[model samples]
Target: MVVSSVEKPIAKQPHASRLYRELAPAYEAVWPILARKRIRAAIGNLELDAGHRLLEVGVGTGMSLDSYPQSIDITGVDLSTEMLAQAQRLVEEERWSNVRLLPMNAEELLFDDSSFDVVTSFHVISVVSDPRRMMREVVRVCKPGGKILIVNHFRSNNSWIARMVDSAGAVTRRLGWRTDLNLHEITADFPLRVERCYKTSPTSLFTILTATKLDA
Candidate 1:
């Protein structure tokens, strides 16, 4: 008698597979290029040394891959399988052996405590449903004295820019994104101390923050 084999379906994290399947194509197309340049500049200014273990949440299309040192060990997580599929392709096409991709939520991570030397996110907070939980998780997994690097566009405090951001919220939401929250509000939830922040042009829309996770 001959026996047949059965293949198990790959399980996905909740609420993410749909969003990723729908949005992954567009996100993969433009984001990799658009975010690449900005992130490179931001990481360059960070002065990170080689051989660091880094965690990148919402690492769509692996744009930040170029910013990290080749000697570093990097792991990237995203909720979208479609996005991860694209990321995998990018990594393979580029022959990057130091990077690993996993499907995960920023609000919850499966990694052990203090597993990473740096936790970074690029333009992610504005879109996640629970930024506070995500921030806390990021801090939790980072080693003592590790840095959290965030480059994001946020709601403007300026009246005119605030109006524009508010107006854009509806459209952005339909496409599965949240309007940028005030940085001050989110930062208050963490014990982190801001090392530096830079305001990019077209104000009230974009900001870059670098914070160091405090030791317990």
Candidate 2:
């Protein structure tokens, strides 16, 4: 899974860049309200230690900064510089000296193998064109036995409910989300063992799964 600096650009279209930039401002205002309960529940489930080296993909506005223990070393990456600027502002104001934010795509992470003890992404899978590639990159940088935490929403499994999700997905897709993603299918492709899996909400709109990288 070693990648080089000469790797091809991860974002294939200019529209994707423009799309995120456009949503960055709206996201800051709306995401906290829409996702607060789910985020709090998910963060409560994370099992992190003081010395963990954590990498958070798509750290928009740094909403989850307070979830990490003060003693842990945290590195956050996002595709939007505008969003990262907000995250930086929050991190600086909170006096989180050990945390750093960088602008990077989840599909092509610029890090050495096994560099992190915990890798996480919150509500980002549906927006990425290649979520499988992003998961692979997350696993690539995570050490053997390290943790990978995901909190996201996908189409419900219940046929009746799934139909409703599909309908809503149609509208949301135009705003950069594939709401019909089969998360179970995506998780199967990764080299990780499930440590915990649970639903955060009854409607199946939100889920939290924590897993560990298998030894090579």
Candidate 3:
């Protein structure tokens, strides 16, 4: 069973899947190359070992799936069934015995508390209707002291750059992504010990955040 059950919150936003379904082919073509280096570096920072349980939220097309250590167990979830279908095909082609792909909502993760040793999401925070809620759920499912990785484009701290980017917000929003998401705004309230939050390069548009969920 490549696809698993997901809850109804996703149904409230049917367009989410529609937009991605149409974009699936292009998404698989483009995102992997653009995100590979930063994602690989971020995963390297996780220091994963055999037997670790990892949950990747918004596992779109499984672009970053092969970068993870095969020894560890991986469960990848995505709201877009079209994307998940591509991911399932990849899992099969590679014969990844340790990976499971499921159709799931990021904001409504159906998992037990502390179910995974690590949780990671890429370029997905802003795509959701409520990024903070998605984050709360991200931290919720991760084991205490477990690592959490988020790699996404957030409003730049540079004033001029932020305003310049804001000009494109209208266009991006119409296409289903908001350009004005702020990193600190979404993550500040969580019980996470932020280890590092930095841009991959001086010119990189995305930020890489590495944090550990605080113990209850």
> What C-alpha lDDT does candidate 3 achieve relative to the native structure?
0.87
On a 0 to 1 TM-score scale, where does candidate 1 land against the true structure? Answer: 0.88
List candidate 2 stretches off by more than 4 Å: 1-16
* The candidate that achieves the highest TM-score relative to the unseen native structure: 3
For candidate 3, the TM-score is 0.94
Q: In candidate 1, what are the lDDT values of residues 45-108, reduced to their tens digit?
A: 7767788899999887777887788888899988777788888998999899999888777777
lDDT of 3 by residue, 1-216 (tens): 123355444555445667998999998788777888888888888889899999999898988888999999999998888899999999999999999987788887888889999999998889888889999989999999899999999999899999988998898887788888988888887889999998878998889999999977
| Two-way lDDT contest, 1 vs 2, winner | 2
Q: Mark the regions of model 3 whose C-alpha exceeds 4 Å error after superposition.
A: 1-10
Kindly give the stretch of ten consecutive residues in candidate 3 with the minimal lDDT sum.
Answer: 1-10
TM-score for each predicted model, relative to the true structure:
0.88, 0.91, 0.94
Cα error, residue 81 of model 3, in Å, equals: 0.6
- Candidates sorted by lDDT, descending order? 3, 2, 1
Give the TM-score comparing model 2 with the true structure, all chains together.
Answer: 0.91
